[model samples]
Target chain A: MADISAHTPTSEIRSAYLEMTHRKRLYSGLMLAVFVALMVSGFVLADDRNAGGFWSGLHRLFDFPAEVLSEASEKLTDLPAHFVHFLPSLIETVNIAAASTLFGAMIAIVLSLLSTRGLARWPRLIPVFRRIMDITRAMPEIVVALVLIFVLGGGPVPAMIAIAFHTAGALGKLFSEVNENASLKPVEGLQSVGAGWIQRMVLGIMPQVAPNYLSYALLRFEINIRASAILGFVGAGGIGYDLKNAMSWGKGQYDEAAAIFLLLFGTIVIVDQISSALRDRLTHGARLEATL
Target chain B: MTTVTTDVITDLKGRADTLFLRKRLLGFALPAAVLVYLAYIFFAFDIPGLADRANLDNGKTLIRDSYSYKTHVTLDNRSGDITYAIEGERKGTYPDGMRPDWVSDRDGMTVVDLGRGNSVQFAQGFARIVQQDGLTVTARPDRDGVNADLPAGPLPDMISASKNRLMVTLPDARVTVTRNRVEVFKYAFGWELFFFTLDSPYHGMGFPTLLSKAVSGEAGAIWDDFWGNAMWRHADVAWALFETILMAFLGTFGAAMVALPLAFLAARNFTPLMPLRFAARRLFDFFRGVDALIWTIVLARAFGPGPLTGALAILITDTGSFGKMFSEALENVDGKQIEGIQSTGAKPVQRYRFGVIPQVTPVFLSQVLYFLESNTRSATIIGAITGGGIGLLLTQAIITQKDWEEVSYYIVLIILMVMVMDWLSGLLRRKLIKG
Candidate 1:
C-alpha cells in the first residue's frame, strides 16, 4: 500500500488541529459570557415589590369585575349578564377587525406592487422606496394612531387608517421580498418571447407568487382584526370603548371586564383554529404540487 | 412572399396592442384611480385641535392664592400704621405713614411696631401696615390678628413690604403676600411653571394638582396610580394593550416555534422525505397566507377579548411566517455537514443537534429577537381592545377631549421604551449569536 501519511503534509494537519481547538475555546467563552449576562440582567430587572401589594392588587383589580358579574348573574335570574354585556361588543369588535383587515389587504396589494424593485425602471427609486417602506414599518401603529386621530377625529377612521397604513408598509415589504426570491426562469422566458415588464410580472411572477401573497394577505387580516378592537381606546371606536369605560369604573366592572376578556380569548382561539386549518389545506396542496 | 410577411407582422402587432390595452385597464388605470381616491380622503379629513380648551389659569390662581401663604396678619382699622417682617427675606425700614419700625429675627416670623392710633387697630389684627415712600409698603398685623379675608376679585398680582417703616423701591415683577394665616396668591409666570401649566389640565385635570394630589410624585406612586387606579379603572383599555402584546408575541413566537418542526419536514437535506418536505412547505404557505392584524380581527370574533384572543390570532398568522422563514434557513444549511454527521451513524435527533441546530441557532435567535422587538409595538395595536395596557391609556387620553398633554407623555414613554427594548434585545441577540 502507498504511504498515505507521506502524501499529506504534517504542518497542514497540525495547523488544522490547532485551529479546531482555538475555535472550541472561543465558542465556550462566548457561551459562558452570554449565560452570565442573561442571568444578571434578569435579576437586575426583576420586580421586587411585595406580592400582597402588587400581585394581589392586580389580581383583585382584575378579578373584582368577575365577582360582580357572577353576583349580577345570580340576581338577574335570567341569561348571564356577563355574556349579555360582552356579546355585542365582541361582535362589533370582530366586525371592525374584519372590515379593517379586508380594507388593509386591499391597500397593501397596491402598495406592494409599487414597492417592487423589478417593476421600477429607475434604480434610484428602488432604495428610496425601500427606505420609505422601512420607515413606515418602523413607525409603531400607535404613532400612526396619534397622527390619524388628529386627521380622522375621534373615531374608527383613525384606527382603520393606522391599521391600513401599517399593513401596507409591512405587506409591501414582504411582497417585494417574495418577488425578489421568485424563480427568474419564467420571467426570462417571457422576456425572450418579447413580453413587456407588466406582461412578465402578471404572467410569470404573479402566478408563481400568488399563493404566498394570498397566504400573507390572510395572515394580515387576522392581525388587523385584533388591532381594530384596541383602536377604540384612542376614541377610534370599537369594542375597546366599552372595555375602557368598564376599567375606568374600577372595582365595580371587573366581572364584565373578565367576561369581555374571556369572549376575546374565545374569539381568537376559534379564528386561530379556522385559519390554521385553512392554511394547512392550502400548504398541503402546494406540497402535493411540489412532490409531483 | 411579401404578402405572407406583411400578414404575419400585422397579426403580431394586433396581439401586442390588445395586450397593452388589457394591462393599462387592469394593472395601471384601475389601481391608480383607487389610490387617488384614497389619498384624497386622507387629505380631506380635518385633524383635531391641539389646544386644551379648559381654563387652567383660573384653577392655578385658586391653588396659589387659597393655600400658599407665609405670614398671618389682621388689622382693627384700615388706616392703622402697621409694621411686619419675614426673618429670612430681610428687615430694614418701613414707610412713616403706615407703621413705625420692625426688627428681623432668626425664625421666619417677626414682630413690628405700629404708630399710636394704628397700634390699637393693628393690635386687633395681626400686623401694622406702614406706607413706604416708594412702591413698597410695610404692614404688620397684631399677633391676635386672624380674620383677614382675601379680596373678592382675582388674587392680587403682587405683594411686598418694606423692611422697616421706610419706603423701598419695588420691581415691576409679581410676588405673593399673605397675612393672618390666610393663603397668598402668587401670579409669577416663570417659563418652567408656564410650560408645566400648559402641559397640565386646569382645575382637577391640571398636571400640578394631579401630580401633587392624585399621583403623589413619590417613588412608585406614578406607577401605582397609572397601573392600578388610572389603568385598572380603564381595564378594557389596559387589556387591549396586553392583547396587542399577546398578538405580537403569539404571532412571532407561536409561528416561530412551530416553524422549527415544520422546517425539519420542509428541509430537503434533512428530511430526504419528499412528501414530508412538500407538506411542510405547503403548511408554511397556508399560515403565512394573511397579514397578522387581519388574523387578529378574524380571531377576535371567534376568541372574543383579552390577550389569549390576540395571542391566538397572532400565533395562527405568525406560524405561516416563521414556517417560511425557518424552512428557508433549513434549506440554506450546509449539506456536506449534515452528510458528514449522517456518515457517523447519528440518529435524526442527533443529526439535527450536531448538524442543523448549530447552523440555524444564530439565525433563529436573531430572528426571534427582531420579532420580539417588533411585537412589543404590535401589542399596542391589539391593546386597543379596551382592557389592557399602554394602548388603552393612550386611546383614552386622546378621546377624553384634547388630553393632548397626557397623550404626548404616553406616546413619548412608549416610543422611548420600544427604542430601549429594541436596542437591548439587539445587543442580547448579538451576544447570543456571536462566534
Candidate 2:
C-alpha cells in the first residue's frame, strides 16, 4: 500500500543509510576497543599476580619440555620398562573412566527420560528433574572428588563416583535434547498395548536413540578418561598419582614422568580416533536412514 | 511351481528365525558384558576394601562443622588466665576483658554455659563438668597426672579418661582437661565473626544499627572490616573468583583468536598445500592430545603458580579444540557467498571479512561462549593444581581439615559462579545466534 522508501527523496535516503552505517561502525568500534582494553588489562593483572612474569616466562616455555625429553632420551632403554611399570595404573585409570561412564550413562538415561517433554513419567515434575541435572552438572568434578577423597581417604572409588555424578548430569541434558527430536508415535503405540513406563521406553524410544546415546557416551568416556587421570593427580589411585609422584621427585625421576606422559598421550589419541570414527558411523547411519 | 514357492517361503522363515535368535543372544550378551566389567571393576578399584578405609567420622565432622561452630573457653591453669576463642583459632579469639555471653568469670572461677543445662567450671587447678542428666565429672591436674572422679555406677561412653588427660564429649558440648590447661568447647550454630572480628567495634552490632551507622558515614570502615575479615577473607575470595572468571574469559577468547588463523591453514578448502594442512591438523591434535592436566603441569613450571599459568593451560588446550572445530566449520562454509563477494572484485581478506566471517560468526561465537562457560569450571580445577583462584582456596580449606565451613562457602560460591556463567552464555547465544 504505502511504498515509503520509493516515495522518499533519494538524497534523504542516502543520508539516512550513511548515518545508520556510521552508527553501526561506531558501536562495533567501541566494542572492539572495550574488548581490547579488557584483554590488555587482564593480561597485565595476571602477569602481575603470577610468580613469573609473562615476558620472562615466554622464552622459557619450551624449557620444561626440553628437560623432560632430555631426561627421557638419556634413559631410552628404561622407557619401555617404565611404561610396563605404569601399565596397571593406566588400566586402573581407564577402568575408572569406563565404570564411571557406564554408571553415568545409566543414570543419565533415567534422568533424561524423566525430564523430557512427552516422554516424562511425571510431567509435572519435569522442572524438578531438570534443576537436579543443572545443579549436578554445575558442580566441578574436582570439588566432589576432593570432598569424597577426604571422607574416603583417597582411592579410585572416590574418583569413580565423582566422575559418574558429573557425567550423569552432562549427558542427561544432551539425552533430553535427543529425546525431544524422537517421534512419539512408537511410545503411543506401546501405551495402547498396555506397556508399563519402563517397558514402553525400553521397547519404543531406546531403539531409536540408542546410536546417539552410545555416540555421546563414547565421547563422555574420552572426557572421563582425562578427568579420572586429573582426579588421580589430586590423590585418587591411578596413573596421575604416579605421575605426580614422579614429578615431585624432581629431576632424577623425569623418565618415569616421561613414560607416563607418553602412555597418556597415546591412550588419549587412540581413544579419540576410535570414538570419533564410531561417532561418524553412528551419525552417518542415522543420516542415511533419514534420506531413505 | 507350488513346491518351489513353498521352498522359498520356508527359506525366508528360517532366515528370520536365525536373525531373531542372534538378536536375542546379543541382547543378553551386552548386559552380561556390562555386568562382568562392573564385577571386574569392583575388584580392580578395591571397593570391598574401601569400607574399611572410609572414615565415617570424618564425614560426620565435615557435615557437622559446615553448619555449626564451636566456641572454646580455655583456662591456663598455671597462670590462671582464661582466654575465649571461636573455633580455637587465634584470629577468632575474644579481645582482653571480653568473652562470649555464655561464659562468665566469678570469684576467680570461670563458668562456661554450654546450653541445655550442661555447664563446665574451670577453677585454679580443677575442671568440673555437669551433664544435662545431673551427672557431674571432676578432673584435677596438680604435680602428677590428671585425677578424674566420675560416678561409680559405670563410666559413660561419652567420657574418656586416661592417666594424664580427661575428655568428656557430650551431645552439645565438650570438656577436655590436662595438667597444663582446661578447655571447654560450647557448640553453637552459624559462622561466628563472619563479617567483623571480635576486635571490630561493629562486631556484634544489629543489622539496623549497622545500617544506621553506615548511613552516618561509617560505611567505609564497616566495609573495610567486612572485606578484610581474617576469618572469611571476603576480599581475597572475591579476587580469586574474579581471577577464575578472568582466566576463563582470557583463555576462551585467546584460544579463539589463536585458532582462527591456524584453522584457515588447517581447512582443506582454504589451503591447497596438503603438507601445510597436514601439519596444521597434527599441530592441533598434539595440542589437544596433551591433556590440560599435563599442560597445567608444564605451564606451571614456566609461569609458576598463579592464575596466569592456569589461563595459559586452558588457552593451549582449547586452542586445539577450537582449531579442529573451526577448521571443520570453515570446510563446510557455503562457497556461494564468498564467490559472490569475489565477483565484486574484493581482495581475499575482504572476501573473508565480508562474505565468510559473517556466515561463520554465529557458529564461532556460540562455540566460544559455550567453552567460556565450561572453561570457568576448568579454571577452577586448574587453579587447584597451579595454586590460584577459589580452587586453591578451596583445596587449602579442605586440607586444613578444620575449615569445613570455609570449604562449604567456597563450594557454594563456585557452584554459583559456574551456574551464572552457564546462564550468561546461554543468554548470549540465544541473543546473538537467533536474533
Candidate 3:
C-alpha cells in the first residue's frame, strides 16, 4: 500500500489477466471447431466411398448375424459334432500360438540380452540391435504371412513364422526393459570367476529376469493366438482357415461356423484366464522379492 | 544345535545335491522336449512337401523385381514395328517417335544394345542375339516353324531351342523369338516412370533440366504429371493411405468418446447399481471377445468393402478395450479430491468435472493414444481383408504373382506409415500427458 510509485494499478492487471484467459478460451474453441470439422468430413468421405451407404447399411447391420444365429439355433443338435470336427483345427491354432511364442521368446532372450545396456555381449552394437528390433516390430505380421503363404503354400507354418517374427521384436523390447532392472553384481561376479559370455548371461542375468520374461512371453502367447487366427483368414492354415471356408459355404454350414466360433471363443477366454493368472502370480512373486 | 548332530548335516548336504541334480536334469530335458516338439511340427506342417508346393521361381521374381525393373523390347514380326515399354505396362509405353537410348533404328533395322557387347539385331524376318561371350544364335520365323541355328558345342542351358521358339538368356537381357513376335527384356535399376507417365513431358527430364523447368514456372505441371501418373496411380495410393489413417483416427477417438461415459457406468464408485455395472462390464467383454477379425467380417456384410467398414470394425473392437481400461482408471482415481469437491457444495456432475476428470484424463489419453498407435496397424490388416487402403493394394499386387515390385513398394510404404504414426503418437503422448 505504501509503494504506490512502483506498483501497477490493480484494474489494469485484472483486465490484462482477463484478456489472456479470453484469448486462451478462444484458441481452445478454435481447435475444437477444427477437430469437429475434420471428423465430420472424414466420416462423410468414408461413407461416400463405401459400397453401401451408411443409412442403408445401418438397417441391415444384423442380417448376417441373424441368419447365422437362426440357422445355428435350428441345428443346435449338430453343434456338438461340429465342435468335435473343429477341435483339431482349434488345436492347430493353439499350437501355432504356443510354438511361435516359444520360438519368438527364445529369439527375444538373445536379442534382449544383446540390446540391454549392461548385459550386451557386444555393448558397442546396442543401438544397432535396437534398430533391428524396431524395424522388425514395425513390420506387420500379415505381410510376412501373406508372402510366406505364397512360398510355403498356405499352412500353419507361415502363420507360425510370421507371428514368431513379430513376437521376437515385440517381446525383445519388453524383455530388455525388464533386463534394465536386473542387478549387475552377479554378472560381475561371474566375470571374476572366469565365466564366458553365455555362462555369465545364463547363470547371472536369466535367473533375475526369467519371471518377467515368462510373464511377457505368456502375454505374447495370448496375442499370438489371436494373430494366428487372423493370419489363417488371410490364407494361412488353422481354425481361421476352417472358419473362412465354413463362412463361405453359407447357410448349410452355419452349424460348422457356430462350432468354430465356440471353439475359438472358448480357447481365447480359457487361454486369457490361464495366462492372466500366471502373469498375476509372476508379478506378485516379483513384488515379494522386492519387499524382501 | 540339537546336540550338534553330524548325521543331520550330511542329510542336509544330500538334499542340496539332489535338488541341484534335479535342476540340471530339468535344464537338459526342457531343451530336449523343445527339440522333439519341433521335429513333430516339421513333420506335421509337412516341411518336405512344401519344397514341391513352394514356388522358388516366385521367390526369385519377388527378390529380383523388388530391386530391379525390366524394359521390354518387342518386335512384331508381322508389322516389323517394334515398341518398347517399361515393365511391359501399357501406361509405360513409349509414344510414337520416341525410344530409349539403348534402342535405335538404322535403315529399317532395330538394334537393341544390351550393354557389354551383348546386342540384338531385329530385321525384316530374322533375329540375331550376339552374346557377350561370343555365343551367337539366329532365329528366322518361317511358314512351317521357326528356323533356329544354334552355336556349335552343345547348346548351353542359357539357350532353349525348339521347333516353334528359340530363347536365349543373357546377363542383362533375355530374348525370346517365336513365330509371332521377337521380345527381349532388358534389365535396369530403379523404378521407371515413378514420377511421370510416358505421356508427360517431364517423364525423361534430367534433374538439372527439371529444376530449370520448375524455375521457369512449370512446377505445377510437373507436380500434376507426377501426381497423376497412370503407372503408379500416385493420387489413388495417397488417398488410400489417407483413408487408412483416417479409419484409425476416427475409430480410436470415437471409441474413446463413446467409452468414457459408459466407463463411469461400469465403475464401482460411479455406479452403485450392481446389475447395471455388471451389464456394462459384460458388454465390454463380449465386444472384446468377438475380436476385430469377426467384427470386420460381420460389418463387411453390412457396409460392404470400404474404409468406413474398417473404421466401424476398429471402433467396435476398441470401444470394448477402452471401456474396460477407462473404468479401471476411473476406479483408481483418488477419492479425496472428489470428496473435497463435494465439500465445496458442488453437484455430482460439477464434482466430476472439477475433480475426477483431471485426475484420470492423463491415463485415459495415454491409453487412447496407445490404442491409436496400435489401431493404425489393425486398420491395415482390416483393410487387407475388407478391401481398402495400402493393404488392398499390397494384396492385389502380391496376388498378381508378377508385380512383386509393387508389393515391395506397398510394403515399404505401410512400414513407413506405421513408424511415422508410432513416432507421432509418442510425441503427442509426451506433449499432452507430461508437458
Largest lDDT belongs to which candidate?
A: 2
Q: Score residue B165 of candidate 2 by CA lDDT.
A: 90
* DockQ of predicted model 3: 0.69
Worst 10 residues of 3 chain B by lDDT: B1-10
Q: What's model 3's lDDT at B302?
A: 95
- In terms of docking quality, model 3 is medium
lDDT of 3 by residue, B164-271 (tens): 999888887899999989999999888878888889988778999999999999999999998898888899899889989999998998889889999999999999
User: What DockQ class does candidate 1 belong to?
Assistant: incorrect
Location of the lowest summed lDDT over 10 successive residues in candidate 1 chain A? A45-54
Per-residue lDDT tens digits of candidate 3, residues A1-292? 5586359788887899999989988997998899889888988998998889889999899998888888889999999988888888888888899899998999989999999998898999999999888877878889888888877788888898999888899899999999999999999999999999999999999889988998999989988888888888988888999989999997777778877877887888788889989999999999899899
Q: Which residue runs of candidate 1 sit more than 4 Å off their true CA positions?
A: A1-39, A46-85, A121-123, A150-153, A182-206, A248-253, A287-292, B1-363, B379-435
Across A1-292, the per-residue lDDT of candidate 2 in tens digits comes to: 3699789988998999999999999998999999999998998998999999888888989998999999999999999999899999999999999999999999999999999999999999999999999988989999999999999988899999999999999999999999999999999999998999999999999989998999999999999999999999999989999999999999878999999999999999999999999999999999898899
Whole-model lDDT per candidate: 0.55, 0.93, 0.88
Best-matching candidate per DockQ:
2
DockQ result, candidate 1: 0.09
lDDT tens per residue, model 2, B1-435? 999999999999999999999999999999999999999998988889988999999999999899899988888889888888999999999999888888776777778888888888879798889988899998888769779887898788998999889999988788899989998888788988888999899999999999999999999999999999999999999999999999999999999999999999999999999999999999999999999999999998888999899989999999999999999999999999999999999999999999999999999999999999999999999999999899999999999998999999999999999999999999999998997
For all the models shown, what interface RMSD does each have?
Answer: 10.3, 0.7, 1.2
List DockQ, one per candidate, in order. 0.09, 0.84, 0.69
lDDT of 1 by residue, B142-231 (tens): 343332333355533443233222111123112222333221111122211112211122212456756566555452544443444321
Pairwise TM-score winner, candidates 1 and 3: 3
